[model samples]
Target: MAQALAAAGARVLVVEPNAPHRLPGLLGAAAPPPEGQGQVAPGIWGLFLDPEIAMAAYLRSQVRVRAIAERMVRSKIYQRFVAAAPGLKELIVLGKVMMVYRGRHQVAGVGGFDQVILDAPATGHGVQLLRVPRLTLDTFGESPLTREARRVQEMLQAESTFVDVVTLAEEMPVNEALELEKTTRDLLDFQVGSLIVNGLCPPIGEAAAAWDPGELRADPRIAGAHYAATWCDARRRMQQQHLRRARAATRAPLECLPFVFSADEREVVAHLAAQLRATGASRREAC
Candidate 1:
């Protein structure tokens, strides 16, 4: 999605929070500065946010004493405080993200990234991350943290904010996706732009999908081939069932990405991006 948006002329920023960052490896681009943005593609930039680095930066921005920012972040007491706080780490990380988002808005088409795509953690951690702003606002009185949280919350709940929920056509992933969609609507009140069902098998005809390799299993020569076909057909059937379930479960647009058979990660991304573009999914957002 980041590359696709960049292709459409939007300057994109991908936030890599998880380390040994996967974005750098997937894009086959050099890792960006730990605290700064670097070009990943023509218009795409990457920002890998080390938690400690983000925390130190956040502290520096908040504290009047610039000299003590680094010292404070490195202190054991600060670490203990962070541990004690429920969503402090997530909030600090989001603080940097909102800084980028705000910076983009400030300079709309002039410079900097136009879109910020956060490569946040899986559903559980992601929910926690998204919940930090509300949590902060609820837990504290008026303070710098609360002020920052307000901005983050505003950005998150903004109509332009699109939470693209990616899932596989399987029970567990579908369940997680449904849970996320429900939470986003009912609890967080965020817009779920799309429900992306990924890695779907190519459609087989009705006869083929229902075909059985009953007699072919006895033949040695074509047994493996038939078995493979049968397995793929079974998978397609299962995928269809889950797809129906997912469609029935959410009103959000459900998009599907076919399973690509390739060792090249770039090929996979390019293929998926093309699929997304073909489906007219060109809307820009802080995904």
Candidate 2:
């Protein structure tokens, strides 16, 4: 999706907070050869936000001293204290995202990305991350931390910020997607912009139903083809069922990403991006 948006002439930055290795592994040969943050494609760039690195950058911005920021972030006591504090880590992560969202970071003289995409934590932790600012404000009154948190909260709640929910076309994941949508609205008052149902098998049931598989049983090759088609048709039907349930569960727009048969993650992302673009629902401003 990032690639598609970037291809459409939007400056895009993908921030991976969950697993740094995941995005790099996906971009594969398309990823820039150099170390640290680099462009994944012409208009799309990737960033891996290590907690310590994010802390150092943030502290440097606050203190205006790189050496002091480095010392503070490297301190064992500071690390332990940050880990011990509830929502502190989540707050910091969100704060870093807000920085990028608002073009407040200067790394090697490159800053102000037009669009910042955060591959944030899973549903539960993501909810917690969004709630941290309000929680801190309520608990700590007024302080530098809470002040920063408030800024992040405002950005998150802004109309320009959108929460996209992605899930598999299955029972459990669909249910979870519904729950996540509700939680985002109820807890953070953020409406889910869309529900992306990934890995949908092609619907071949109509063609399968018109064919007679028994006639091909005598030929192994034909029989194998028939069997594969039958299996795919069944899976597609199942997915359609789940997709219907998902649509009924939410009022938000829903999109299905067809299953791609490729070992390359870059190909998969490209396929999904194409699907996203075709939907004619790509919100350039909110992305």
Candidate 3:
């Protein structure tokens, strides 16, 4: 999605807040700079942030105590503190995200990014990570922490900021997507943008949908072909069922990306990018 947005002439920054960053390798870029952005392409950049690094950076700027900040980050007690605190880690990571989002962080010669796409963890953590600001406000009451939380909460609920839930057209992922969508809307009050359904099996024509590989199973010459076709047809049918369920359940618009069969990551991204670009164009026309 980042590549697609960048290709469409938007300055895009993809932030991987999760550990063991994979976005950089996926985008064919070298490891991101420890504190700033790394260029993925002409219009696309990537940033890898974690709680400790972000907290140290924050303390340096805000407290003007660089030594203490570094020492605290390196300490076992500080690590446990972040782990024990409910929303501290999430808040620190999100603060870095906001900095990039608001263009406080810059890429020299190119200025700040037009869009900051966070590659937040998807296994329920993404939803919880987003809910941190609201949770902080509820627990802390009126304080400096709550004040900062309020600011982040307002930005999250703003019309300009949207959370796009990406999932596959499978039972488990679709279920998670639906739950995540509702939580973001009802609890977080954030606009649920498109429910991007990835890895969709392309539609089989009516004839193929009704194909009976049973007849070809008896023929030795094409038995393998028959088996392959049968499996693909079955997979496609399953995808359709989930797709229907997703469309029926979701309030967000569904954007489907075809399953790209390729070993090269660039080719896969390019294929999806073309589809996404077209989807964006159609949406603009409709609006």
Pick by lDDT: which candidate is best?
1
Can you write out model 1's per-residue Cα lDDT over 1-287, one digit (the tens) per residue?
88777777877888877577777667667665434556666777777767767776777777888668768878899989888877877887887778777873222233466677887789998888999999999988999899989999998988778888889999889999999999988898889888889999885544554566677768886677666666788888898899889988876878888988798998898888777776764433211
List candidate 2 stretches off by more than 4 Å: 28-35, 60-71, 282-287
- Residue 152 CA displacement from its true place in model 3, Å: 1.5
Per-model TM-score, in order, reads 0.88, 0.88, 0.88
lDDT of 2 by residue, 160-244 (tens): 8878888888889899899998888877897677787889887655586559978668999988778888888888888889888
Residue pairs that clash (backbone atoms under 3 angstroms), model 2: none
Predicted structure 1: clash tally: 0
For model 3, which pairs clash?
none
Worst 10-residue lDDT window for candidate 3 reads 278-287
Error of 3 at 258 (Å): 0.6
List all candidate RMSDs to the true structure.
3.7, 3.2, 2.9
TM-score of 2: 0.88
